[model samples]
Target: MAKARILIVDDSPTEMYKLTAMLEKSGYEVLKAHDGAGGVALARQEKPDAVLMDIVMPGLNGFQATRQLSKDQETAGIPVIIVTTKDQETDKVWGTRQGARDYLTKPVDEDTLLKTLALVLRG
Candidate 1:
């Protein structure tokens, strides 16, 4: 079977690299974008199985991108997980409202990330 493809949309180079490495090690095909607009474009073009997004990007923020992706018929079925530094309850609620399937704080746990990815993919 083919491995799942995941797009990592984050402005932080370190975060992007870490996630890519981890996902690759765990047998997931990783795609990357440094900003939200690029992320959305990639989501449309690549149609990745899932998206791990960051909220504090330079333009079009993750929440906005997620809303667009979730609402657009072409990308609506792809699950989005907000992987961000925002840890407040309000932030999580806002992400969910924006159509994120799940949320993960910065310094994402390897186990949790894998588990969340599996859960969303299965759903």
Candidate 2:
């Protein structure tokens, strides 16, 4: 079977490394972007199976990026999972409103993240 392709967008190198390592360990092919603009571009170009997006960044925030991706015809079907430090009901609701398939808080637990990924990809 082909490994799932995941695009991770975050400015934090450490977080990117950690998530990349976790995804790779679980047999995924990873793509990366450091900001929201780049994330959108990568999503359009790669059409990854799923995207892991950060809420805050220099260029564009995750919400805006997710909105753009969800609206675009070419990338609309790609599932986005917001992974960020914002851990509030409002934030989660907003992320979902932006068309994210799932929302995960920072310091994300490995099992939960993986399970969410599997669920989104399966659907």
Candidate 3:
């Protein structure tokens, strides 16, 4: 089977490097975007299997990007997982409302991230 391609949208270079290294080590193909607008454009063009989105970014935030993807016919089926520093209960709820399949906070646990990713991909 082909490895899943995961698009990671975050403005932080350190976070991007960390996530890319982790996902690559697990044999998943990683696509990167520096901010939400670029992420949305990439997602639309590439149609990656899943998206890992960060909430706080310049231009289009993750929530808006997720909403756009979820509502658009071409991208609606693609699952988005919000990966952000926002850890409040309300933030979680808002992420779900924006159509994220799952939510993970910054300093994410590698195991939890992989597990949640596997689960979402399974569905």
* Clash count per candidate: 0, 0, 0
Pick by lDDT: which candidate is best?
Answer: 2
Candidate 1 CA-lDDT value: 0.96
Candidate 1, 40-93: lDDT as tens digits: 999999999999999999979999999999999999999999999999999999
Any residue pairs clashing in model 3, and if so which?
none
lDDT of 2 by residue, 58-122 (tens): 97999999999999999999999999999999999999999999999999988999999999999
Name model 3 segments beyond 4 Å from true: none
How close to the true structure is residue 50 of candidate 2, measured as C-alpha lDDT? 99
What TM-score should be assigned to candidate 2? 0.99
Query: What RMSD, rounded to one decimal, does every model reach?
Result: 0.5, 0.5, 0.5
Instruction: Evaluate all candidate structures by whole-model CA lDDT and list the values in order.
Output: 0.96, 0.97, 0.96
Worst 10 residues of 2 by lDDT: 104-113
Task: Report clash pairs, candidate 1.
Answer: none
lDDT, candidate 3, residue 109? 90
